[model samples]
Target chain A: MEEKLSVNHLLGIKNINQNDIKLIFKTADNFKTVINRSIKRVPSLRDITVANIFFENSTRTRVSFELAEKRLSADIVNFSSTSSSVSKGETLIDTVNNILAMKVDMVVMRHPAPGAAVFLAKNTNTQVINAGDGTHEHPTQALLDAYSIKEKLGDVKGKKIAIIGDILHSRVAISNILCLKKLGAEVMVCGPATLIPKYIGSMGVKIEYNLQNALKWCDVANMLRIQLERQDIKYFPSLREYTMQYGINLQTLQNLEKEIVIMHPGPINRGVEITSDVADHNQSIILNQVENGVAIRMAVLYLLAMKKTENVKN
Target chain B: MKKRILLDSNHTKIMLRRIAMQISETHGNLDNCAIIGMQPRGIKLAKKLLELLTEITKNKKIEYGELDSTFYRDDFRKGDKFLIPNSLNIDFLIENKIIILVDDVLYTGRSVRSALNSLGDFGRPLKIELVTLVDRKFNRELPIQPDYVGEEVDSRAKDIVEVIWAEENSSPEVWIITDK
Candidate 1:
């Protein structure tokens, strides 16, 4: 009944220091144990309702959050953009208020517009978990990425991380860059000149366009999924040209540091952004990121719900 | 809070000796037997058992491992972060080996459920026997019973047992810290 953690409300990784990350990792480690059992369900969030509001289409992130809610024993009400009143021109706030009227305890929202989750949090009494908000942030994905890296590399501090692909359109890359930098890792963003933004370097990240240079200096090469939706805007000459230049393949990987861990935020575009061999390789933490996603989200939800309950009681 | 001495250091040492003797008599020898201590105080208790059992059986080959049920707890996501020590250094294979799962307290049988979950990550054991230093009754939510209990205490829901080891509290004692 004591106040726990609500890590999703964490707006920026810049505010979180090493000790905070350690606490999150420690808490996530405990939840990892809860997931391995035959009877994995816990009564922590019993009778609590969590709304899954997605203003976009998804498979793994959506299902992972739903499963996380169920595992915590919370009732789920899923709202998709296609089925909701958004199709009828209703605003995001109006739809959220409608769900709030039903007394949902928490809302996990993913929208195409940046700052949508933050906006919902300001308007609603319920806790807002940013599953993904346009190109702004996906905190849980970043947390799981950090967790996966910590599990493999023992510590992320001083580790050189090369985040390659469409840096401008990738929420995953943005989150990972912020998180990795906060945890004391030197982050590098490398991609085609059109795809990589120049201002991202202001976030204290080093920018590189040459994949060979980025791959050589990095301890972790994180290949972000190139949002195909952004391709039509002339970000590159062509998909084949982009893959030929920047896609992490067997040849690029061979030139990379052998101990370097490969990572990707899923729904990978095979032969477009990354090669199948590197994605499926032993060094890849892509699947581990998915597994850690559930645990991290569970930790985030439990913490937020418990904190709100404590605030009300107080 | 009532200061109760369920099993003092001496009594615990003697009970561990007797348990070792019984195990040897029934299970042939202590060669294939491993003593796994549950996290926090259970690990210390198991280490103590290993020391006592070694003295009684005169077999120095008894393996000791520690298991942290922090990850395996049912209420893990529900509760506040209570930092405990890391997991056991279990190197040997548990397959076909007799495993004695040790814990400091047994109340509501939930911790044991967590311990069993923690055990499943390791290789399967031929036999797993649950042992607890204290067994408080009428709180079990699961169908689990400890194989060996050092002491049985009748308690209400408000009454909680705090087992302090010298490693943590600078002294070893079992006390009933009551809400009333």
Candidate 2:
């Protein structure tokens, strides 16, 4: 049997295969041209309306998704968790249903609970795009990260990528691991023993605790932010100890034999996971990742809208 | 399957020269005129025509752009198969200028209509004209006709007319592939 990418709902990176990722990259390539033009707007989604429902705090992801929707000419309605009825004890289903009653064509949601997106997809009548779901997955972020690597290195296959920092609680790390491995990249996770998951070896990834060796062995290093709010119990003794063990500083980067590209899914704790000099270095493609995020998201929303239009026709 | 070769590489060259002369005779000197091609296939014809026009006018400057109509189509997303968009590379302004829209073949005029809608984002033009290599006269669903044509052919609903270029096809030939 042949597997096909179902565009009904973009729940997670696990739901899509490598070909689907390639297709998104191809579409995003076209959109990158659209954005560079003098009139950086298209009427492809003019007939459609989208609702951005963020049940968690975000600055970059929310803004990226909103700009993508606007560039597609889709009418957007922004709903924040602080101002929305979700704070008044309304269930997820009821809040979503009320929003749908106003006639929204799609939903881009960010919730703090894992599997929240899957639950919405199973219950909602509209198309669902997961912005982020707890510590489960941030598929678009992973996609943009992969895209940035492709743009810089010209390919993702046969490249070594080392993910550093809080591996256990970072949704970006899990999604990037799945995405990079699927694209045929050698992936390794390096962090403190407590921060790295116990059963991650079952998922077929090399776990490394020594940051220097990991940096030397990899072509690219993606630094993840340590989520202090998400961590319930103390995973490590102190921040200073963790920084000394795993932090990517200018001195360590200068000691490397080859020039390695650096990446960080931002809201960076500066000196904790990555130093200021390394983050602003010439090899760092962090800003490129942010720019590609809009294109990746535009590709997702456009393709899913096309699928939805096809369904309506039938 | 039955195939009929309408124009070979030599005939294609001659016809392209004739089309260029016809365009030159009408516009005199193409200073404010821009040649825009419908992407995926029209690009080849437009490029050839632009080169010929440049030669005929003794190296006069002319603008050439490619427009992708995938997103502008009215029937977009209505098909069961996935739609892949082509590259759009129009960098020049079209406002108050003569626009020559070029394509390989003019059939139902649906693609031209889509191109018109897509061109709205980049300023409005003073005038727009259609130029095609092959005009399938009886196949037009809309009341549209090309102003400048290289050849006229009669094709059935099941017959496919293909313009093969040296860059893509093994040989440069204009032929019709028919279902026998």
- Flag regions of model 1 displaced more than 4 Å: A1-17, A33-44, A230-232, A256-259, B1-12, B18-36, B54-101, B105-130, B134-163, B167-180
lDDT of 2 by residue, A1-314 (tens): 12124667888899888988988888899888887767788778888899999999999999999999999999999998899777789999999999999999999999999999999999889899999999999999999999999999999999999999899998898889899989999999999899899998877788999999899899999999999999999999999988999898999999999999999999889999988999999999999899999999999988888888677877
Worst 10 residues of 2 chain A by lDDT: A1-10
Residue A136, model 1: Cα distance from true site in angstroms: 0.6
Query: For model 2, how does the per-residue alpha-carbon lDDT over B103-158 read when each residue is reduced to its tens digit?
Result: 99898899898888778777789889999988988899888889898889899867
RMSD of each: 4.8, 3.0
Point to the candidate with the largest DockQ. Answer: 2
lDDT of each: 0.77, 0.89
- Taking all chains together, the TM-score of candidate 2 against the true structure is 0.91
- The model with the greatest TM-score is 2
Restricted to chain B, the TM-score per model reads 0.84, 0.93
